[model samples]
Target: MSSNIQIHDIVITEQLSDRSYRNRNADLEKQAFQQLAKQSSYGAQAILNALCDLTLSLCDADSSGVSLLQVVDGEDGFTWNAMAGSMASYVGGRAPRHHSPCGYCLERGAAQLYSYPERFFEWMRLVGKPIVEGMVIPLYGKDKNAIGTIWMISHRDGHQFDRYDLQIISIFANHASAALRMQELY
Candidate 1:
């Protein structure tokens, strides 16, 4: 909403004219899915943690995590339920429901790409690392309602996440949505 928030919708199927990464590695994606499937037996939290690690490695991101919608004292917000990479220490962090990028993505019901979010979110500056690029995908529940978001962030100044990265993340997001629905059932 603010001028500092520079974000745009990323159509998952439309490859950007100016690509960053070449293309998705089918072998790598297969291996990542295998890893996730193997970890599925460990339960939801484990799966979410594994997702974060996989996203960090797969996207070459500075940080990756899952943010679940939550209510604390009747105030809506998001809890960083899982995290990996440079932001691992923020695993239990909480952010406002409406003011953050993930929240906006859920509201729009689409994937979003953001650059230098801290420049607008102000509070993100506390994380100590500037987010050069932040991509967020909304996660959904079995009833087709918004549940949370899984995201990747790059701290490198000029890093550009192309369609290949989005393609991979979209798969991760589907896995995440299923996992969350399973978690809710038990």
Candidate 2:
């Protein structure tokens, strides 16, 4: 634990709306999917990068990134495989699978909105700047296995997310999943 870290013992959630908020942003939802469709011509890395970008825009988030699960020496964890916006400095970083939000999303196998994510994993507080709100969607591999999670976070107050944003992020995650399986840009 870093001495510079602080815990408020409080959670902040302001803009979280009802699950039916999807109906409010119908046109924006369609625009997001259509833009993602046009991103198909690019390679895996490019696609992931674009997906991150789309996540930031579509979700109206301060930051967005994909954390891919990785195993080293049999110790399982996640790596910030790709990122965009505010938290981008943590790109290529590692987080424990047991207490990480991305890990929780993967385990749940569903999209989730996390309020004040740092409370779940204190290490997230060790990063440069913590995100107050996060929406994460699981990413799948060719075998239909969960490989990672694509998430968007907002560092600013009064900028929370809803189900519609989750759906939009899911669209890009699905595209990244299939594209990653089909192409190996490594």
Error of 2 at 185 (Å): 8.0
Candidate 1 residues 1-186, lDDT tens each?
456344443222233446766666889889999998887788888888989999988989889999988888898999999999999999999999888888878888888877677766778889998888888888888778888889999899878787777778888889867866676732
Model 2 over residues 49-72: C-alpha lDDT tens digits? 878888877777888888888997
Q: After superposition, how far is residue 172 of candidate 2 from its true place, in Å?
A: 1.7
lDDT of each: 0.82, 0.75
Task: Kindly report the root-mean-square deviation of model 1 from the true structure over all alpha carbons.
Answer: 2.9
Question: What shift in Å separates residue 181 of candidate 1 from its native position after superposition?
Answer: 1.7
Alpha-carbon deviation at 100 in model 1, angstroms: 0.5
Candidate 2 CA-lDDT value:
0.75
**Cα TM-score of candidate 1:** 0.89
